[model samples]
Target: MIFVNILISFIVIIILQLLGMVILSKMTPFNDMEELNKGNVAVGLVFGGQFLGTAIILGVAAYTNSSIWYMALWFAVGYVCLLLSYWIFDWLTPGIKLSDQLKDGNKAVALLLACVYIGIGFAVSSLII
Candidate 1:
């Protein structure tokens, strides 16, 4: 029974992560996989940060909740927070458009945005408890 529960949890988490990525891809103007294929480090960094951020929240949600439904609910909350953080970052920088900078291959902008995503993820993960 324990093994089965663990397997189910693993599968659910993977599905949630994929769903998060799909949603993120839709939110962005550029194609993430295509940029990644073109060796765009800026896109890679931001996408990696987004993946890690969502993973952090999913980890917390899985750790704190035994029920899959509750885990899913928390995951949803965490995902929304991550998305909002990106929007907030854009709002904070009124003079520059982050997506445009990223598309232009600005490594510095990518690094800062990645950091912001990870930082907010850590903060939001703490609240999952």
Candidate 2:
């Protein structure tokens, strides 16, 4: 049963990560893969953060929950929180559009956002148990 739970978690986590990527891509106006392929460091930073953030949440959820379904449920909560943090940060900052700055390769904004995502992941993970 433990092995089965682990296997299910592995599959579900991968699916969740893909879903997060899709949602993120839809949020931005530019093509995510195109930017990454073009060697855009700003996009790389933010995108990397998004990936790591979800990973952190998933790991914590899996660790805390005994059942696979419960783990996925907790993951959903953390994932929603993470997404909210992203949108809230963007909304709070006026004058400049983060998506545009990212496309233009603004490392400063990218770095800040990356840290935000990572930080939120850790913060949310702590509350999981």
Candidate 3:
């Protein structure tokens, strides 16, 4: 059933994105949801960045694969690359922990990180085809 495939893909993508966010939360020094509840714009920017990045990759995965399983598998691959990009970003920054800065509500770092994530997402997605 085509509708069933669509439903499965939708569910799988939702789960994968949530899992990616959960893993990112674990890597952070603060609770993202709590910060959002506290009106932390910096945290909001970073989350938006990561979400955009993952969405781009997911879009590409879905476009390139006909089978739902292949789509899900490729999405997982892209998601892993997204996670690695964050770590690489952390290592690349000079003498500052990116996550800590975000927790401290640094808007500049948050914006920069967000832009970097978006750019990386585009870059990674471009490679998927």
Q: Candidate 3 — which residues are off by over 4 angstroms?
A: none
For candidate 2, give the lDDT: 0.85
Off by over 4 Å in 2: none
Each candidate structure's TM-score, on Cα atoms with residue i matched to residue i, is 0.92, 0.90, 0.88
Model 2, total clashes:
0
TM-score: the better of candidates 2 and 3: 2
Clashes of 3: 0
RMSD of 2: 1.5
lDDT string, candidate 2, 1-129, tens digits:
768867877898899889888888778899988998999999999988988888898888887776667767766777788789878998999877889999999999999998898898899888887
Candidate ranking (TM-score, best to worst): 1, 2, 3
Comparing 2 with 3 on lDDT, the higher-scoring candidate is 2
Q: What digit string (tens of lDDT, one per residue) describes model 3 on residues 1-129?
A: 889988988898889778878877887878988988998899899888888888888888788877667666766776677678778888998787988888889999888888887887788888876
lDDT order, best first, reads 2, 1, 3
Candidate 1 backbone collisions, by pair: none
Q: Which numbered prediction scores highest in TM-score against the true structure?
A: 1
